[model samples]
Target: MSRPNCEDFRHLFVNDTPLMDMRAPVEFTQGAFPTSHSRPLMTDDERAAVGTCYKNKGQDAAIDLGHKLVNGDVKAERVAQWKAFCEANPDGYLYCFRGGLRSQITQQWLKEAGIDYPFITGGYKALRRYLVDTIDEVAAKPMSIVAGNTGSGKTIMVNVLANGLDLEGAAHHRGSSFGRYVTPQRTQIAFESDLAVQMVKKLDRGIEHFVFEDEGKNIGCVTVPLSINRAMQEADIAVIDDPVDVRLARLLDDYVVKMQRDYVAHYGEEQGWILFAEYLEKGMFNIRKRLGLERYEVMLKSQQHAVKMMQSNGSLTEHDAWLAPLLEQYYDPMYTYQLSKKADRIVFRGDYHQVQDWLAAR
Candidate 1:
């Protein structure tokens, strides 16, 4: 039976289709789709050698060299891995960087191994291009920015909305100094891929207008695609006008209680506490210059004292000593200035429920 090439990239992404990436490890590391599992046809060193041969010699010579390099037990081992992945993900398709020689060779080898599998036409490049285009396409759709002061539960609101896009969640960072999770942030390419997939999935559900949290271009290390960011800047804004007391309680739950619980769950009690303390201290120290020397020192002392109190007595109340001021002095003023710039775009300003209802009605 002849093997067919898969070309429905949208279908693949929307359904979370499994993909077998047959690119070299180095290429895979730089960027790849979220559903793509790396099962390289050649090792980095082998690919490098083959590439050098192709540059100096020709395509035929390069192909011969690749075969020689990946032959025998080496070839058998790779084929075994591919076979196992196919067995595990029977519906999955495989692909190389360009859906060229590497993927074809892998597909042929799989045939010889008694398993016939399809490969993605145009491969990783085509899939990536499709996603990139998706971002640009969706950017043209109507969108609203959910803007608010820090700790106003903007993320919570975004998550609750039917058409909302969680950009920070895609970046795996919370869009603040204190936003780092125990897990590392996604690579820039991975972040974009995730965001594009999200937009695609939402669009498929017939969402006409998207709702997004107001954010600067960069979230952690990942930058939002320029088109989307530009659209967000011009989009109508719904501000969450929760008072300081409300925001403070929310911040404590998020930055302190829930964050500490997350660390503890990931690393266990002793090590988790050490890292959690470091996370908070480092977050504060990251903005020391802006906080000014005296103010930074004061907050640092309060934060340290708060950490010790929690460590000693298991009490969380002391955190408000620094957190309250951190909000009033740092985040709130910064938010006020930022919101002022976008003042003309603000369409509605209200507490959480009001904003929620406004967005829902839209």
Candidate 2:
């Protein structure tokens, strides 16, 4: 039960060792490791009480109150939960805000219960710092940015790469107003943690070249790490040259069919459609500045018509009328202007399959 058999702290990042976050639910929700499960050493109320004691009386008083609060059946139940987690994941480690009192106490209690488990050396804050530092360090390496018109299946191509990192996937967004997913986006810290984890895994595998979709500074609410964004700005661009029709079909599949499916899966069918329609409306409204009031109204009307047609058991093709014009008038010009500014960065330009082959061969 001693700390001699403790797992190495870096192993938590590089390997699949599970982590039991002993921070309260509120703290854990704010941020924690991906592999972590919330198993608090104290309830939120108990933690607040202990914190107040620390502030008012001192550390000794807080410790006394903490022990007093978690004693008897409450302590026993928590120990049981920790024991179960340890038993299930023999390599599991525990952590607190600073790898200090709380985790030490948890480890000590578990030790007394005959469950010999080690905790993270520096705790949640330390591990988070390490992960954040790793992101900038890894961002120094060369990156290849996948670029194409909207709906060119650039995300799919990035995903198919051997060394591809899905920035949008990490953000739980498609990187646009309409790109909201049924699931919530990660907190900023969580998004950075995820991005760092991907890079760490790739680097650990001896891969130096990282590939990902070209993205703006923000993917939804999460900003790309500054260093990574800088590298992306300097990275070579791989463009997808699929025809308009091909790209349009992909947009429909992703935006309409897959989006509706996700919404229904999260919220039942009846409510899902309603939410989906709202999402579309919001997405359109969000782009009103770029679309101009008149053009926005036109697009909105077409979108509403498409929604009604779908509701009436009409074909998805009905969406093409608005989508095509939206792309032609809005998305294409923006993307083209952006790409033109970086014309020197374009490394490979081809159709989807051609790009796939080009990446695979590399």
Per-residue alpha-carbon lDDT of candidate 1 for residues 159-249, written as tens digits (9 for 90 to 100): 9999999999889999899988898898888898999999989988999899999999899888989999999989999999999889999
Question: In candidate 1, residue 146 scores what lDDT?
Answer: 94
lDDT of 2 by residue, 61-163 (tens): 9999998999999999999999999999986788999889998899999999998788877788887888888788778877788889999998888777879
Every candidate's lDDT: 0.92, 0.86
TM-score of 2: 0.93
Model 1 is weakest, by summed lDDT over 10 consecutive residues, at 1-10
TM-score of each candidate structure, all chains considered together: 0.95, 0.93
**How many pairs of residues collide in model 1?**
0
Point out where model 1 deviates above 4 Å. Answer: 1-5
Provide the clash count, candidate 2: 0
